[model samples]
Target: MKLFHYIVTNRLCHILSTIVIAILISTTCHAAKTKYIWQSSDQFVALEQQDSPSTNTVAPNDHPATVTSETISAMLSSLEIRATDSDKPEPLFTAVAVQSIAPQILQGLRQASPTEDVTFAVIGLHNTSYGFVKSHKVTTGRVYYQAGRLNILIGQAQKEVNDRDDRRLAPFTPGSRHKTSEGDWQLLPQPGQKGFSLQRKDWAAFSTEWQPPAAVQSVSPQQSIPAGLIAPARQPSPADRLIVLKELKEKGLISEEEYRSKRQEILNLL
Candidate 1:
């Protein structure tokens, strides 16, 4: 009888130890997956990180649609200008989108697309000094596409003037324009407005191949398929199906049980 009691007690202790170890592992994983929220900067300073999750929600009017490469090119083709006291309009030197960066969930901001928001690092150049001198005015900023419109928020602007001998004229004048007091979200002005007037320009000369970043490319459903095998009616491979299923589960579009069942179904195809 004593031997039976000892065996039962030993088994119970082992089970309890296993349960505690599993709980610790689960907690560690949850903590590692925590992401930081960042705030937009005016001086283009390093983004401030926040520990809490963002509570921001998108409004109907501000929700962005899925963006394509053409959409980005279209936005970059237009230059924003503001009417000055003189007859000639003053160019705001709006930066053009040169590279696409992965969109992040910003606090008090909405996603720019179905899966994520679209962001771009932009650059603009103009002549700070009159004539065909070597003096150049450069502006850098970030562009966010939302509500079918491009919202540009200039981060920093500086004028670098060089002499006829290619010598430095000034010590890189900073903040050449008037200081902007608007918040990050408030900087987005409607098209044709003073700060956001869209003046069309010939952008074909400046065109470059635009490809989504690697992070965005990985989530594409067609990434694993060969080019020759691509067709409108072609069926997705088991690997492709599994990739999509996992994405849906991560996005919370499917429940845990549904994910497990669908995942098993895709694995069976292999």
Candidate 2:
């Protein structure tokens, strides 16, 4: 899995700047990082949710199938979506197709479960989109959806700035999983949406059915370690310690006095 360096998200009123003097980690220049995506058919139920069907249950956008949705239309079926902007009552989720992310998605989809309704959401400091050259040398950027079952390219209804990622996953720390108050990762408008605001009680309720971690194997009380094999309490084994002492002395890790002390301990064990 390849990792692309990503930047922090700056608010519009605020500028989310990268680390002091950063580099643009091109995805093609480097391979896409292995990212964990959380998906759910019921994500909308947790939204300010006004009854929305998932991409699988909804009609295909135009006609092509997808795993993720950038625009509302891409994620929803034929239902009338209220425009976040009343001036554009056309649809809330408009599909802004960035063809660059498509081929990779198609390729990943081939590797996922054929029957699963896969959705991928991430909140992290990673590039959500990348640039690619078209046949005619056209430069383009698109949202990259890489997950099991459906590696389809989708995006926010109208966002086209591929170099800039959705602020969605920006705040997530690298190499850690995030849990909402709901205890589920998928309860967002998109995956890892802004301002995780689930109530503490809701998080508790969600965790009620969450099973406790499987019990680690219990060691038998008879599995007592032999005291003779315990060696010295604070040191390594005599044979091993002797080896270390010799190496350290040879490698100049210890003075002669320290070497003598260790050497004597090794003999004392015998």
What TM-scores do the predictions have? 0.29, 0.21
| lDDT of model 1, residue 160 | 39
Residue 173 lDDT, candidate 1, scale 0-100: 15
Backbone clashes in model 1, listed as residue pairs: 112-117
CA error at residue 113 for candidate 1, angstroms: 8.1
Residue 143's C-alpha lDDT in candidate 2? 22
lDDT of 1 by residue, 1-270 (tens): 999999999999999988877766765564354232321211111121121235544333243434454434443433343322234433443322122122332321343333232222222344343534323333444343334444444433333323332112111111101234222111212333322432221101111232222312343665576676533664655654664566567667899999999999888876
- For residue 267, what is the lDDT in candidate 1? 82
| Clash total of candidate 2 | 13
What does the lDDT read for residue 135 in candidate 2?
14
lDDT of each: 0.37, 0.28
lDDT, candidate 2, at 9: 26
Q: Which model scores highest in lDDT?
A: 1
